[model samples]
Target: MKVRAATEADLPAILAIYNHAVVHSTCTADYQPQTLAQRRQWFDVRVQAKLPVLVAVGEGGVVAGWASLNPFKERAGYRFTVENSVYIHPERRGQGIGKLLLEPLIAEARALGMHVIIAGIDSENAASIRLHERFGFRNVGHLPQVIYKFDRWLDVVYLQLSM
Candidate 1:
């Protein structure tokens, strides 16, 4: 597999992976699948900000996963901090695609002079928690029932890695 910065052509696959999680799991708090136009706008915002949007390409050039660093908050004081997101195609989960995508993202963040990278994850996502831990992200906070999804209250765990 090869990891590279995503092009516009990769957005559809990335949106599909993200929407699958939105519909079938509590990985993201978003209750509805985002439209292609919305996803494109999001991509444009990231690109305009010069943040990294990376994709993992697998055999036959399939987009197996994608990762990005997003502004953690809108406030000016939060400029040096970014929130990390990674999504793998449902069929490609557990194959280290997330690791491949995130490892490069961390490096990219450091290169961009970011001070910190945060990951807000569902508390029930043990695999993701473990993956972040492996990358030196420490659990900084846990908020109980902060998100309502899948007809239930979902807990969120915040992890941070200082660059």
Candidate 2:
């Protein structure tokens, strides 16, 4: 596998991975599967803001996973902090692809003068929690019932790794 910066060409696979999570899991709170145009607009915004979007490509040139450093908030005071997202192909979990995709994003964020990297994970997602923990992220806060999905109230845990 090889890791590299993402481009427009990766959006289809990225969208597929993201929509899969949205439709099947609480990894993301999005209730509807996002359209390609929406994903493209998202990518464009990230570009406009000069953020990093990375992808992990595996055999046969498939995008197995992706990670991004997004602004935590629109307020200027929050500019130094970034929120992170990582999604791996369901069939490709437990193979360190997420680690490969996330570690570099953290480094990139720090290089860009970010003070912290935050991961808001579904409270019940042990794999995501463990993944962030392995990279020195600590559980900083929890918001109960912040989201309602799959006909259930879902809790969210905020983990932070200071740069």
Candidate 3:
């Protein structure tokens, strides 16, 4: 497997992975699968912000997973903090792809002079919580029943890693 920066060609695969999560999991709050144009706009925003978007490519150059850093807030005071996201293809779960994608994101954050990295994860996702914990992220806040998805209320846990 190879971990590197994403290119224009990788957006479709990334969109598929994200849409799968939107339809099948509560990891993201988006209720519907986004259109390709929406995904393109998202990519453009990230690029304009000079943020890193990385992909893990496996055999045949397939995108196994992707990760990115997003601005934690819009205010200038929040510029030093970023929120991180990682998505692994369902078929590629439990293969350490999440770890591989996240580790580099941390380094990228540090390189960007970020003061903190945050992860707002589904509270029920123990694996994701554990993955963040393994990377020294601490559970900073928990908002119960804050999201309605899949016909039920879902909780969100905020994890943070300060540099």
lDDT against the true structure, each candidate: 0.95, 0.94, 0.95
Full ranking by TM-score: 3, 1, 2
lDDT of 3 by residue, 21-47 (tens): 999999999999999899899899899
Clashes of 2: 0
lDDT string, candidate 2, 81-148, tens digits: 99999999999999999999888998899889999999999999999999999999999999999999
Q: How much is 109 displaced in model 1, in angstroms? A: 0.2
Which ten contiguous residues of candidate 1 have the minimum total lDDT? 146-155
Compute the lDDT of residue 41 as modeled in candidate 2. Answer: 93
Q: What is the per-residue lDDT of model 1 for residues 1-163, given as tens digits with 9 covering 90 to 100?
A: 9999999999999999999999999989998999999999999999999999999998899999999999899999999999999999999899998898889999999999999999999999999999999999999999999999877998999999997
For candidate 2, what is the lDDT?
Answer: 0.94
Distance from true location, Cα of 116 in model 2, Å: 0.7
**Residue 10 accuracy (lDDT) in model 1:** 95
lDDT score, candidate 3: 0.95
Ranking by lDDT: 3, 1, 2
Quick one: RMSD of model 3? 0.6
